[model samples]
Target chain A: MIEQSINKEPIIATDNNGIVIDIRGLYKSFGAHNDVLKGVNITVNKGENLVVLGKSGSGKSVTIKCVVGLVAADKGEIKVFGTDITELDDKQLNAIRIRIGFLFQNAALYDSMTVRQNLAFPLKRHSKSLSPKQEEDAIKEALDNVGLAEAIDKMPAELSGGMRKRIGLARTLILKPEIILYDEPTTGLDTITSREISELILAIQKKNKTSSIIITHDMACAKLTADRIVILKDGIIEAEGSYEELEKSDNDWVRSFFI
Target chain B: MVISLKNIFNDAGNVTQFTARFFKEVLKPPYEIKEFIRQCYVIGYRSLPLVGITGFIMGLVLTLQSRPTLAEFGAESWLPGMVALSLIREIAPVITALICAGKISSGIGAELGSMKVTEQIDAMEVSAIDPYKYLVITRILATTLMVPLLVVFADGVGVLGGYAGININSDVNLLNYFSKVLESLDFIDIIPATIKTFFFGFFIGMIGCYKGYTAASGTESVGKAANSAVVAASLTIFVIDMLAVQLTDIFF
Candidate 1:
């Protein structure tokens, strides 16, 4: 599924070192439900694709949500870029989030804004001093990177499903984030389009040298982009290995995903 | 009934907390001035026609409805004074706010609710943008500032509407009607009314934003949010109006 793209490059730079995100003893629950993530522990080395694979309601997305501070863990230590985000206030959490990019399953483009405006939104918000020319160049480069330079003037509603995903990716990339969290990146697309998105995710991970946690049940996506994969079930990590390694596991449940 | 009462109280508490967050966020730096100006244009400028037409019709209808009753006492000559006082003191602000509560509040509620369910608001947060400041503060400020201005315009237009209504059956000139209107009005009548509308505008924006911002994660919740925004804001308008009248009576 990992088709060659024009922008493919090595994911790790010579300067990359140490852990970028380290989660320890993570636990969360909704209301009176049992723990969604019970004693969950994970780590992301610099510039590596760590895919979290789980069935629906297995708390895969919830785990990433906690790292980004979007969903607080009931008990956990989420250290992003060495700072324990669980202890940070909203202002500090925002500061950390500025370095992290999250793509929701829907792509979540601001429907009211044009593609250009959507791409430019974060730049305008975070970097108040950026001149108009700098803003224009950044927006154009982002769309160009996502192969949707022509759709810059169009609204989110006007774009096709694939194009919206591209635009959503472009909007995220415009900020040049250090880490990206993809929530079900290829959930509803056809096989070819899903493959294309998966490849783009690889291209992005390599080109930007970004550490990522790709959350998906899409075996093709996990197989294509994951340097390492973690299988989550029953509120904890069940297995962690490479694609080929996981495929040869003795457990039928884990092997079912490869099949 | 108890469940319904409990839900209402719960909702009220949520809205109060949301408003508190609004104040806290609004004070933070990077105030989103461009977005704020754009909201003023959308919530205030774009709503002029609806507010204008509705205000005109209200004044005309209220004057026409009250004419015969006053005429029975041979107080027909006092119609302009009475209508002007009523329009300035209560009718224009209250009516205009209710109209805005329908137009602007629902619009904000539905817009934000859609953004919420669709994850646009969350997208903003991850993009390092302050969603509360960008979405909530700009809107609440726009509504608070714009609604009073709209009411002032409506008051002026409603007076013209009263003249039109008065001329419908009788031979009252515009200038003469206005003179009577001006003679009937006092600073006491105009000041409190204008001031109270700021509260109306604030609550309208607040309830709408709060409902939309905190809407449950679903499609139906968007519609629920917009509908609830209108209901809650409209009810709050009446409550605030009653309080404003009482406070005015006691103080002025």
Candidate 2:
């Protein structure tokens, strides 16, 4: 089912470097004093799990949001699939957006809709050619991928935190996006649930062969899912390495994250 | 004081921009007919009982209260026609709109405000769905179409309540009372009254949606959205009513 879903997508050609996402000299400021992101540059390969670890208010989420064009940057360039998104109009931006999936911190499911409706919403919008039965199958397959087929009929209000996160992932996966952005995906879950979510992220990367930017402060999640990890501080990428290399780093500030 | 005044102007500018966007998006294709109908049901069908009851009481009390005053002039026979004129021309439309401003406006406000704070609006945007078209346009269109129908319904119900009120004082048959009401009403009276309700409805939906859609990120902002929706909608209704009446007077 996953393979069938993936097969129908129109693949986007990346440049020779296989860079799916590239940001350069990105600068965003909320107001006079609060500079959330300043001169930030990052790159995600075609199929890699790039984890971004940051303290609170370190512009981690803002950086990923800029890549998706959710939050506009005051200055700089954001290239998704080798196209700079800041220059695109709403129609063009939305065309780019459909190929990307976002998993918000709180799942952000439509409260008025059942889990089935939530998963079906994007599919119905972007893939209007699919028959009702095919849509149903897709919803079911996505739910099965997240291991929450039973919660299909439940409302977001009825689901627990972990279940809601899984349902969110299901909704994101239902679209068969080429790149998924996980914003604090495991933030409010218990340790076991966090690990479960982390494992799910890893499994998705392997099965879907998709690039991802997982914005999380959970070191456990980072250690588990990250193919390469970057620590964000003072509105920039302060350190970049594998989880073990970062743990054995000489910098006290970077090592503190390992502790 | 200077900052707060600036904030007010800022809010007004934002609302104006939002309203302009509504006009722009509402014309575009792929219209959300299903969501629009669902909103009509929720905003119109569900509020019937409340508007009906309020209309009934307003008509009945106005009839009963005006009886003594008319009797003092030995013009008690004018009660039915006078009450009909008042309810249809002014009372029913304004009162029904105010009730809706309270019920419908507050509901849309809180619903959208919660959606905003919880990132549902952002979710819709990231999913490549236009939240303005799906959420705001459907609601404003629903209210714009439904509020006038509700006011017409209120006019009918209020007249019925006036009949009941008249029966309490004297033995007046339904046929006689309705004849008097019909005699008192002109085609001109209904047209202006109904036209104004449409304005009332448009603003009610627009204000509620505007407040909720622009809500600050917090749980408390949800309550504030709901509260301010009612206030702004109610105020706008009266302002529109005053203008409508003035225009009607000058033209007719």
Candidate 3:
């Protein structure tokens, strides 16, 4: 049996005006017979940190992917910053993507590029207004933001796992995106490093007022960074509330995460 | 048999989707120009020696083996032209393409397929980076440009190898053999064969990237992508080669 703690009413805060992302009735399937996501819906508000918690195969990543138009949904609607993502052509999708930042699990730093180039890539692609010197300055500023200014010349392979994640974060910050999606940011890091990343994420949210949707199974990370938590089960939202509200819920799956 | 047919159809459908996605993504802006150049170096320059050696040896062995047979008919003098024409029109390009299909296609397929399986591709997408253009276009461009150059190198080396074999084993002088080769081989023969190599390159790169890019499920899918890339590329090369030959005969 599925837990039913998800509130039917949309939770809206007065301070956050614009809806950064809105998903409704999203469905995706790898094959004809097996559906990965089934009628999933969530809305993320501007400047809010929304953490999606789920088991490994419950389609939390797929939901975020649909919002970004990375994975095409079989049937659904995804609106990012009020633009319908699914209806957009490639050029339009790309134009919209410039304002979004994503930090991947493995960093996905181009193995061929140095750390500075890795950080500079998004800036070079998205921001033509910045001159070469300005780009370099922005790259340095991003690296400094993640405490990685010293490792700019090193290749990703040379960096440790934590360093790679930080560099990835640095790359994400260069775009100064209003919406940042973090996938498993603390999955493999030690507690101290995880907490450090959590602090960095919180600091970023506070400084930039950037809304974020972080997908992770790490409850500690969710508790630390989430302004609101959403739990996904079987391709649907199972529970959504603040950490305290989720902790107090009578649902076994929600309680299991805390225990 | 019925189940196997169904699987084959499913695979064909997947390949079609992959091709469609590739077209869709290639039109998008923010191209990765630097990554394309780096891939060109890896796919083209790095694989040159291997292709060259194999092409040369094929020509040399073919000349050596055919020498006695032609000699029996008092046709030893035909060795140079025969070998050169064969190398230019068929052996060199096809062999080089096959070798590249095995090396480059499998490499691209395995590399990207593994990345897909490990969720690296998904990560790139989330990062607002077009993984298709970054990974696929760079690779496709590399193969398209490099395979033709590799074929050229292979053709030159193969002809020289044939000349060398003939000079060493028989009374044919190097100058005479090369002159015969030069007289017999025309631009007509060389151009079409070389042109078809571009198509060969495109198919090899496209199929490899497609199979790898859309690879699904677990770790086994990476291996499957690599395998399918080689298989698909090889089959496509032969089909294109046959068509090229037919078209060349019809027009020229």
Top TM-score model: 2
Evaluation by TM-score, superior candidate among 2 and 3: 2
Q: Taking the tens digit of each residue's C-alpha lDDT, what string does model 3 give over B172-200? A: 77778788999998999999999999999
Residues B1-252, candidate 1, lDDT per residue (tens digit)?
A: 999999989977887788888887787787778888999999889989998898889779988999999999999999999988989999999999999999999999999999999989988877657788889999999999999999999998888888889989899877888888989988999999999999999999998898899999999999999999999899999999999999998999
How many clashes show up in model 3?
0
In order, the first chain's TM-score in every candidate is 0.92, 0.95, 0.92
User: Which of the predicted structures, 1 or 3, would earn the higher TM-score when compared with the native?
Assistant: 1
Please, what are the lDDT tens digits per residue for candidate 3 over residues A107-181?
A: 777776799877776666556556677777888888889998999899988999899999988887777777899
After superposing candidate 1 on the true structure, give the runs of residues whose Cα lies further than 4 Å from its correct spot: A1-17, B1-9
lDDT by residue (tens digit), candidate 1, A1-259? 0112111222222222578988899999997866788989899999999999988888998999898877889997888877888887777777778778888899999998999888877777666567688788888888888888889889989988888888898888877888999999898899999999999999999998999999998999999999999999978999999999999999999999899
Candidate ranking under lDDT, highest first, comes to: 2, 1, 3
Q: What is the DockQ of each candidate?
A: 0.83, 0.87, 0.44
Task: Give the winner by DockQ.
Answer: 2
Question: All candidates: CA RMSD in angstroms?
Answer: 4.5, 1.7, 6.4
How displaced is residue A11 in candidate 1, in Å?
22
Candidate 2: TM-score, chain B only: 0.99
Better of 2 and 3 by DockQ: 2
For the predicted complex of model 3, DockQ is 0.44
Evaluate residue B153 in candidate 1 and report its C-alpha lDDT on the 0 to 100 scale: 92
By TM-score rank, best first, the candidates go 2, 1, 3
